[model samples]
Target: LGERVSWQTLATVLIGLLGVLVMLRPGAGLFDWAALLSLGSAFLYGLSQLMARKISDTESSTVMAFYQNGAYLTGALLVAGLFRLAGIEHAVHPSLEFLVRPWIWPALPDLLKMAACGFVASAGMILLSQAYRLAQANRVATFEYTGIIWSPLWGFLFFAEVPHSATVLGATLIIGAGLLAFRTERLRAAPPLLVPTGDTA
Candidate 1:
């Protein structure tokens, strides 16, 4: 029980830190409130991931993804329903209907973009799970920091959003720290069950 609690707490802290970083980005109202909301999201997601890891050995990745996504979809629907019950027309209001409308039906190009995002995200998760099974969780989690390096290029190409130098520097530090910790943990562990490289040589 203590071990479980400790894992949950650590996950919460990492996620909370991520939230702080996200809220630092421009364009979210109530900087303080956004930070809080971001932290909450991070905490929940982190907890969910840790729980997923615990069960990964028992179930297939397809099963995990289905349940994980199902949970998220259910929560979203509940929220939407609550808002409707409260007589709120939408989560956020806009001056123009086009600006605020949900993209249930979009033009071809916009639909293509959404589809691409979904494909990339799903593929990334499959690869992530496979990596976790082969290596330690921390090691694969560290590689996720590479998104920081890639995000700027993606933004520049797709959205014309140039990243700040600070963002790059911060991301680099995070990636380095995560990788360093993971490598240290691996080193401390006993030798792999498989044959060593020297045996093959």
Candidate 2:
């Protein structure tokens, strides 16, 4: 994996991470213990990508997606079981509450929405698994920063929320970094220029 990454790819990854930090703007007061959980999640995600790259040659993407979804389903069930058995008090914090909440049957409309969400998520995972199978992890990772551009667009379309200038600027940087990485990859892939060994007759 290390051997597969070039300096250009590393630079692009750093630039993409910089864009993420600029958007998040973590500060002294902004730091929260929950942020560590997010960081851990990101680390696991990167690890999974690395693992995908390692096995992609031998494993089918469908098989990868199947295992990934199975793991998620198992984890979700285990968490729900633990929450139920522990009988923990209702959490005041939204994140904690969501985690510990007991399962309940949703209304028909809500159930449909949940099903739709699951379908979309599963489809996305399958596509991502295929992408990892088809490309080097480092070469494709920078494109993940494109989420920064889509977030605000989705927010505006779905929730009528407008983004601040900082978001716009950060998205621009993220996109620029992705474009730079793609260009670098393209140039690297181009055939080397031929040099004449001797003067033509």
lDDT of 1 by residue, 1-201 (tens): 113233533453364346336524555353544356656876787676667677777877767777776787799788767655676545442422333344377899998998998778777666665565555454455555556567676888999998776566666566655655555556657586785667553
Q: After superposing candidate 2 on the true structure, give the runs of residues whose Cα lies further than 4 Å from its correct spot.
A: 195-198
Pull out the clashing pairs in model 1: none
> Lowest summed lDDT over 10 consecutive residues: which window, candidate 2?
22-31
Quote model 2's TM-score.
0.90
Question: Runs in model 1 with CA error above 4 Å?
Answer: 1-30, 89-104, 178-201
**Superposition-based RMSD of candidate 1 using all C-alpha atoms, in angstroms:** 6.8
